[model samples]
Target: MPRILAIDYGLKRTGIAVTDEMQIIASGLTTIPSETAITFLKDYFAKEKVERVLIGEPKQMDYTPSESAKLIEAFVEKFKNNFPDLPFERVDERFTSKMAFQTMIDSGLKKKQRQNKALIDEISATIMLQDYLSRKNF
Candidate 1:
């Protein structure tokens, strides 16, 4: 089976994650500047057989769309335009960042290492992909 890719889209940086060919495990791929995300994805798609793409949908505590949703929506539009043949879905991303930070603390990452926002973004993407896999039983 082709691998599935997940994206944690942020204003400045975007995190990427991918599943194994069998779609069993999710692993962080990279973190890139948001401005170059599409270019990065285009290259990655050329190198891998990605079955589908998953993007985190930010939501507020009341289950309403968060302010970041606008930026995400804009990005989605660009993504669709670029990869019209590719399919993509949105997964709830509420608290994924917090979870990633807590995970870092639990894993005993040093303060300096944990301060890397790019690393946090990558971990957030990994967590989002894992959550999707868990829900789908894949």
Candidate 2:
């Protein structure tokens, strides 16, 4: 029972999340520079067992691909080339950021703490992972 990883990809920063081995919980892992995300993931995978990777796919209100999608696609292409054995899936990321912000607020985080973009990113990834888990059976 390997864990499933989720990625909220961005041009400057990337958010990461991972599920427990039992696939019952998804938690924020960390945020890293976009340029270093692949190397980071490679190192992480070498240390941990990951069943698959779910990347957040940004979309416009009309369901069209967002401008940031090109950046994500490029990164996904390189990631697949680098880790051919690992499976990858895309999850709709609409409103995840807003949801993350609300989560921070509900958690009683201070204004300054909630303003941290890295924290927002990580939480966004967590939300995306949770959404995927809810829709997936088992």
Candidate 3:
């Protein structure tokens, strides 16, 4: 089976994650500058068989779309124009960042390591992918 890719998009940086070929495990792929996200994805698609893409959908506590949603939506439009053949979905990403930080703490990462925003973004993508897998499985 082809892998499913997940993206945690931010203003400056974007995180990427992908499922195993068997679709059993979600793993962090990389973090890249938001400006290069499309180029990075194009290269990635050339090398991997990706079945779908999942983008993190930011939301407020009351479930309203967050301010960042506008930027994400613009990005999605560009993505669709670039990869019209690839289908994509948006998954709620309310606390994935916080969760990633907690994960770092639980794993005993040093403060300096935990301060790496790129690492946090990558972990957030992984967490988002894992959450999607869990929901889909049950």
Candidate 4:
């Protein structure tokens, strides 16, 4: 089976995650600059078989779209234009950053290591992917 890719899009950086070939485990892939995310995905898809791309949909406590949603929507539009054949889905991303931080702490990461924003972003993407996997059998 092909892998399912996930993205945690931010203003400056975008975190990436992917499922195993058997689609059992979700793992952090990398964090790339938002400016270069399209190029990065293009390169990645060229080498790997991704069945779908799951983008994080940030929401507020009231379940309304967060301020960051506009930027993410713009990026999604571009992504669709760039890869028309690729499928996309949205997964609710709430408290993913905090969850990532806790995950780092639980894993015994040092203070300095925990401060790495890129690592946090990657972990956030992984958490989002894991959450999605847990909710759906797919």
Best by TM-score: 3
Please provide, for model 3 over 16-103, each residue's C-alpha lDDT reduced to its tens digit, 9 standing for 90 to 100: 9999998889999999999999999999999999999999999999999999999999999999999999999999999999999999
Over the stretch 4-34, how does candidate 1's per-residue lDDT look in tens digits?
9999999999999999999999999999999
Using all chains and alpha carbons, the TM-scores for the candidates as numbered come to 0.98, 0.98, 0.98, 0.97
Best model per lDDT: 3
Query: Which residue pairs of candidate 3 clash?
Result: none
lDDT of each: 0.95, 0.95, 0.97, 0.95
How does residue 108 of candidate 1 score in lDDT? Answer: 99
lDDT of 2 by residue, 1-138 (tens): 999999999988999999999998899999999999989999999999999999999999999999999999999999999999999998999999999999999999999999999999999999999888888965
Q: List ranges where model 4 is wrong by over 4 Å.
A: none
Q: Please list the Cα RMSD from the true structure of every candidate, rounded to 1 decimal place.
A: 0.9, 0.9, 0.6, 1.0
Candidate 3 stretches with Cα past 4 Å from truth are none
TM-score of candidate 2 on Cα atoms, chains taken together:
0.98
Where does the lowest 10-residue lDDT sum fall in candidate 1? 129-138
Give the Cα error of residue 57 in candidate 4, in Å.
Answer: 0.6
Global CA lDDT computed for model 2: 0.95
Clash pairs of candidate 4? none
Stretches of candidate 2 above 4 Å error?
none
Q: How far does residue 54 in candidate 1 sit from its true spot (Å)? A: 0.4
Pull out the clashing pairs in model 2: none
